[model samples]
Target chain A: MALPHAIMTALLEDDMSGYELAKAFDVSVGLFWRSSHQQIYQELHKLADRGWLQCATVAQAGKPDKILYTLTEEGRDAMAEWVLGESRVQEGKDDLYVKLYNLSEDNANHLTAEISRRREHMMQRLYLYEKIRRRHYANPVSLPVRRKGVFLALLAGIRQGEQFLAWCDEALAMLGTIDEPVE
Target chain B: MALPHAIMTALLEDDMSGYELAKAFDVSVGLFWRSSHQQIYQELHKLADRGWLQCATVAQAGKPDKILYTLTEEGRDAMAEWVLGESRVQEGKDDLYVKLYNLSEDNANHLTAEISRRREHMMQRLYLYEKIRRRHYANPVSLPVRRKGVFLALLAGIRQGEQFLAWCDEALAMLGTIDEPVE
Candidate 1:
């Protein structure tokens, strides 16, 4: 329900500054739970206030001092407990589905174009996830306990992406054969 | 972002009272796009005020007259234009992914139990979708333009549900083999 719990999992690996954390989320953690720079910084402060995350200032010779965020023991405890808690399964909102739901002979061609564009986009994302898998999780089955979680999480996205591409293919093919409406 | 467009698509099939519209959403339209009853009712009023939907009163001898909603030409125009408009592809938020991301030796078993429960739940949903497929979309290949859209929309949810079950299986299998944390 909250971003702190997700952020704690992101911080489990190593200490990171707010900027670094934002970047990390943009690449990995953000894939599941999205957060903005302002949001991550705000939550970081709130977590530190709750004694869940400890913040330390690292001096930089040529720039402003960097505040690094480290997950506290309390943070890890909170994350571990949250991990085992009952969570809701979400039905995600996709506008493409809305278009498809309203598909008619009139808009079939237009909708298929949009779907084709989406297919390309999904493929790019799959490529990115595959690159991540190869570079980071080359051997998922043999990964240690700590590392396995990240691999599986990324795998979830990869599987969804693959499934999405298939759906797009199914849609495009079906829409391609629609006859013009009899006016 | 607005539910009105999606609700308009639902009303395109037949004129229905707010109650009927809500029920229709629960069964079919709510797969990719979800809406609460209150939200649906509110959006219906907004669409009527916008002159996109017409509300007609039908009297019942035994009960209060029901106001049924029908999509106007303007509503069709709106939905048509909106369908052709560019929209974002979303990465949905799923808590299971977060839990899997945090998976470690300590919580592996507990997490897998939750995942197993989710797997069963997903199977139930798949069964329901399959029933819908059999009852309605028996011949997807030959469906008319008006009907094909609904079939494809339902197909998207089925595909995603199938992909989710696969992800759950992957997570459970991996977590099942995790080694205890070295103290």
Candidate 2:
């Protein structure tokens, strides 16, 4: 349900073909809300049917025609309403944490590898977020008013990644000290 | 589903009736993996069917018999296998951050209230986590080897909540200075 709203927000930025939207999603909206290409395509049809989006076919000189989607007035209004409405706090369902909670000496070696893998993953995300911050928000005070909120959301992601990395370090240190049982 | 796995973890800690499990979930397992009472009951039945759990009925004075669930050998094996396997990193889907990304002067006032509400909620959780830490992990170094992993997971939750609260503070500070358009 919220996918349509996320799509509307992306379309508000620029009208694009489904291919462009999927690529853009991987970088931006998808950072917060993940959806598969198939799901995105399906939602596009539903949104077009509901009149929230209008699609236009553009024929290329050497390629097949592509459909570009843009938001309608209703879609814009709906987005505005959603912004002003109450937000739901999403429940956390981190499988890594669950694994940690159930970890035993028998599986300590396996978990140590997983912790390292997760730390590397968090490091990559942190690097990406920092890159975004440097590129878009080097001078936060000079940013346009419209971009300030976007910057805030990015900051949240950056902070989350940093905190998680710190926790991973602590976990690795603790795991290193615990003696693995001798076979 | 992960629900069954989470259920198994809770049951591993202590065998309890369906009602007791539900209440325990709200306080403990629910922190990491959320599920409704109905969903818990449904999964319980499925787990029993899968031979991962066994139920025993015990009659109580002035009350109907209650069925208590305990993990079987197969369930233990499943949990151990799951722990050793790769953990899927859950995608973050925070509605507040989405709204923040799309916020405009028109909806700024509404988002301000939401940020405050979320900060208060985070504060409550922080307090509860602190209480648990004091009661159970005041001396973490002295904790049993088996409990070290659980302590680490709780530490993760505490750190995440703290970081989220800090982000909420930053958001409120930024929103306060933005000039709202005069209606």
Assess each model's interface with DockQ, reporting 2 decimals per model. Answer: 0.69, 0.75
Q: What lDDT would each prediction earn against the true structure?
A: 0.84, 0.85
The iRMS of the candidates, in order, is 1.6, 1.2
Prediction 1 TM-score vs. true: 0.91
lDDT of 2 at B54: 99
For residues A1-183, could you state the per-residue lDDT of candidate 1 as single tens digits? 847877887788878999989988867778888878999999999999999999889999998999998988888888888887788877668877777788777888788888898899889988989999999899987777767888888888898888988888888888878876688
Per-model chain A TM: 0.89, 0.94
Q: Give the range where candidate 2 chain B is weakest over 10 consecutive residues by summed lDDT.
A: B139-148
Candidate number of the best DockQ: 2
lDDT digits (tens) for residues B1-183 of candidate 2: 478888888898799888888898876767899888898888999999999999999989998899999999999999999888777778888777777778778878888999999899989988988998998988878777557888888899999999999999998998887878897
Candidate 2's C-alpha runs over 4 A off are none
Worst 10 residues of 1 chain A by lDDT: A89-98
The best candidate in terms of TM-score: 2
What candidate 1 gets wrong by more than 4 Å, as runs, is: A61-64, A179-183, B57-65, B179-183
